[model samples]
Target: MGRGRGRDYTGRTMPSPSSAIRPKRGKKGSETPIVTPVSARKRVAPSRQVVRGDRGVKVTRAVTIRRSADELYAFWRQIENLPRIVKHPLTIERVSDIASHWAASAPVGDRRVEWDAVIINDEPGKLIAWRSREGAEIPNAGTVRFAPAPGDEGTEVTVTLEYNPPAGKLGAWFAKLSGQEPAQQVTEALRRFKALMEAGEIPTTEGQPSGRPQNTKAKRS
Candidate 1:
């Protein structure tokens, strides 16, 4: 203690530097955190195909009518007669040389389906094609072709149709359950049209009378 050393009040001897002094520790080793910018990210837009899903309906069918191509084409070109021939509740109003308004049966009587359509192609006595306008009640398009049969069997009428029903394919299936399928309706329409054109009347078990012809006279004199 007398050899140049410091001591506490109660200490008989003070610890030497060799035993008391020690090195201090460095700061804990830890890496800094990093951040990313929002502007450097990738984004994707929606696709129409996914939204559309499986809502398309396509049908191709043909019928051979005992009438000439020109006669069939002329009769079909008169849009007003569609309701009578289609075998469904339908009405067509001509807007111009290329456009028209159409209404067809749906579920109820007064609450029918309606749309506007424009004639896209018109090959006289051969083909007629049409498509519905944008935002229609039921979007649709179709084509009708009239060609001479191989023999004297009149004309071969081929109809091709593609449509997006209001309820899509599901709607078509539902229509089948309700006996309102378009394909069957078209086939029946073609058959009825053939009967009407060739026989001047559509046959019915109800015995309904056919309308008078253009060359009919009465004995009113």
Candidate 2:
């Protein structure tokens, strides 16, 4: 006769070990959350604060010149005329009606940095704005506005410039040390521009005598 089914002491068929029902593996959604001990948690390093002046530095200057708004606007609208009015050793070459390439001598070296810029806004006899294009050595932007001065005092020209120097704050510091700070440069440029517009020339004291002992003696007649 064939082997009969195995029975336990209670006379019930006993389930074989291999045939016993087991818990089925459930999907990932049914997993329980993991909890790590406080002592075993990782410590994340804190982040550093960003430098404030890294973005750029801004300088604004205003002047009143005894010239009509249209005349000043026309002169300034021509980008090629910039070097004629400013004291800085700057050169600009127009690439198109609204774009130009600019180069200027660095304050601490014989090196010259250049960039291309495009006009972003223009309003005849009112305002003009421009910004440097991508990959510029020193990114910069500027705006010039012309408005009527009080009591027929001619036009008020205001210029605002924001730039990120080549080395950021360090470069700005060097510029200040070399007497080429943007603020001072802008102020002097406007002064020169005013003189040129009103007097038709830039007055200067070149070759003037100084209070040095060697130069105190006059030439014998």
Candidate 3:
């Protein structure tokens, strides 16, 4: 029966030794393995673009006020007094020593948009810087600096600001397209400051009540 089975199996040929055998291993259990093809990696750089505006706008305005540095700095240092001079005065509510909340209305196209800013840098008689708070509708940062003029007889005040309008690119484009002037605003504020300082009086807040009585009646004789 074994001979018959072998004769029948002979009709089918077996696989070659080389094809049927497994890869041999090295003596120390280390064997040469098949190598995988490595893919090439390319690095890409990110583009630098302003999310609000293509390029930031820097506004600088300076004026030589006929006042001493101390006087100019004194008035400018009072952030709460800004409304008296600033063309677009905003209500500033002090929150702490280093921070204050601000609400100002800024022109945007045909209408105005309200912004809430937070005071950042406050150096008496020197500089004041502020930016919009976290949840403000419009984002902006502005600085006001006071320095003595060359002659030391007058103060040279400079104002610089970087604001991201509410409308984003559209607002920036509109501001550029409208040709709306900033000089007038700056000049007006300076004029107001000059008037206030020269008059030797700071503007009074309407919210405060006068200590004197509105009217008094005389006693009948």
How do the residues 1-221 of candidate 2 rate in per-residue lDDT, one tens digit apiece? 31222222223343321221111124231122111111122331110111124345544557889999999999899999889877767899999999999987765456677889888778899877777777776667677888999897899887866665556654774466425445556667788888889999989987688877666776434
Of the pair 2 and 3, which is ahead by TM-score?
Answer: 2
Q: Which RMSD values do the candidates have, in order?
A: 35.5, 31.2, 33.4
Question: Per-residue CA lDDT of candidate 1, range 138-158, in tens?
Answer: 566677888888987898887
Q: What lDDT tens digits, residue by residue, belong to model 3 across residues 124-213?
A: 776666666555554555667777778776777766554443467546643553234333355457667866877765455755554445
Rank the candidate models, highest lDDT first: 2, 1, 3
Error of 3 at 199 (Å): 4.0
Q: What's each prediction's clash count?
A: 0, 0, 0
Alpha-carbon deviation at 64 in model 2, angstroms = 0.7
Q: Pairing residues by index, what is the TM-score of model 1?
A: 0.64
Worst 10 residues of 2 by lDDT: 43-52
Question: What's the TM for model 3?
Answer: 0.54
Compute each candidate's TM-score over C-alphas. Answer: 0.64, 0.66, 0.54
Return the lDDT, model 2, position 76. 90
- Please report, in order, the local distance difference test score of every candidate based on alpha carbons: 0.60, 0.64, 0.50
The whole-model C-alpha lDDT of candidate 2 against the native structure comes to 0.64
Indicate which candidate wins on TM-score: 2
Clashing pairs in 3: none
